[model samples]
Target: MVEFAICLPFVITVTMAGAELANYTTTKMRISQLALLVADNASRIGSGSMNAKTISETQINDLLTGAGLQSGRLNLFQNGRVILASLQPSATENKFVVKWQRCRGMQQVTSSYYTATNTTNLNLPVTGDIDGITVKNHLVTPPSKGAVMFVEISYTYQPLVSLQFLPSINQTINDSAALTVRDNRDYTGGTSGIYNAENATRSLCAQYTAT
Candidate 1:
């Protein structure tokens, strides 16, 4: 009886910790899935005609709503500054980019499953910030050469389970995806020169914003 009493606490603690870890893993997967969805949508919008208006907050908000994600709960950042809580077009023409910052927070599990609470703070985490999406038009001066748009999206994820016991666990996970527009269209001549425009566009899309 004495041995059972001494071991009970240890067993309970281990079991509870395992459950917490599992919950964290599930949340991480969800975040990754959401990030990909956001990136794909943003890229598609940016690929529209150069005459098309920049991606608007209303449009992005509508997309989030359609995806069953609360737009108000998301923090959208562009370039390096946090834009509208949802998304709004800036002065930059023919560009639409989005970055997924810290979307999930540490998990808090209680003794009872029914009472457990999981908190997700949309703000950036201390470890680091995730990269945002970059959408740009790949056009050059020569009218004969058609233009194409490109998008690059990146994400930084941290594991909720601490590394104290599980040394094999990775502290962070980083993932990125890139897509180029299929439409071949030419852009109007502008003050911006067209030398190596496509490469420059890709470079801009590759820019990383601090979380």
Candidate 2:
């Protein structure tokens, strides 16, 4: 009976620890896939237009909403953050900069690349980098005059087991993905003027909300 008492606690701790590890791994994978999905979808957004494709504030918000829905029970918007940037080449500067940026989720985290001043073209640019940003050890360079849709997602791990059993496992998980824009887009003024109506609200980087 004494042996059983001592061994039972150890077995339970081991089992719970394993569950926590599994949860962390799954969350990490989900974050990675989410980053890829956002990048891919953002790249395809401006296609199918006869005129120069333009991205709007409403459209970017919709993309963020879609990501929140895809997160399911992960509560990603509540406990995590997503930053999407349009990396473009500055012809005169001979360097790449973040032309525009949008963000969502309640987490108080910003992009690793540059601070976003606005969701539109007037945002502060990141100069001096030939390639816009690095993701998974590779530089995501904008294609010629076109732009690259870059996404970064960060999530705080939610453990399935008690913290007492897995204090170290509950850390932040981060992943990023980038893809060149599929068609010619108006990377000039961002969501200004005709692209975004007067009443539309942009998903500006400063705001932190789940919606």
Candidate 3:
């Protein structure tokens, strides 16, 4: 009986740990793919102009709706958030700033998610990290006259096992992806943008406030 008692806890622990690990891994993979989906879609929205690619407010809303739908597999709406940022280079400052942003989910957007003023472009983790060490925080030269679609997904993981007994682990997971626009883009909502949620669907712009 004592031998059984000694091994029983270990067995239970292992089983619980396995379940937790499996869920964490699944969430990671799903969030990563989610980023890819949103970024790719963002790249395609344009005015069909040879000179510049641009996205309208309606298009942005539609893309956000699709993001929410694509993320349905993860039940992201219940506990996660996706932030879509538009990165376009400014002719005046010769750098990129968060032209605009939209989101889904209930979590507050991370401060690191936005394009920083004085930052060169979205390729850099922080767009305004000019003159920083290249190895650390710094802006890569954005594609000339082009832009990037940046997607960030953050989720709070709810463990299947009780933390009171298990080893500590972070309960948050986030993944991001960025892709250059196939063509140059205009930042002014693509020459007359859409405002109502009809094209937008859901309160995407209201989901996260830029900090």
lDDT of each: 0.32, 0.77, 0.62
The C-alpha stretches of model 3 lying farther than 4 A from their native spots are 47-54, 92-94, 115-141, 163-166, 184-211
Per residue, candidate 3 scores C-alpha lDDT tens digits across 12-35 of 888887887877777788888888
lDDT minimum window of 10 residues, candidate 3:
127-136
Question: Which portions of model 1 miss their true places by more than 4 Å?
Answer: 46-162, 182-211
Could you give me the TM-score of model 2 versus the true structure? 0.87
Ranking 1 against 2 by TM-score, winner: 2
Q: Pick the TM-score winner.
A: 2
RMSD of each: 15.0, 2.7, 5.6
lDDT of 2 by residue, 89-110 (tens): 8765657777667788888898
Model 1 Cα lDDT, one tens digit per residue, 1-211:
9999999989976876686577547645654555455545544543345653233334434443333342222222221111111121222443322212112112221111011122132221111221223324322111123221211122222334454434565534333323332233222222111123233221121223322
Find the 10 residues in a row with the least total lDDT in model 1.
Answer: 108-117
Q: Quote the lDDT for 163 in model 1.
A: 46
Tell me the deviation in Å of residue 165 in model 1: 4.4
Question: Quick one: ranking by TM-score, best first?
Answer: 2, 3, 1
Residue 133 local lDDT, model 1:
31
Task: Let me know the TM-score candidate 1 reaches against the reference structure.
Answer: 0.38
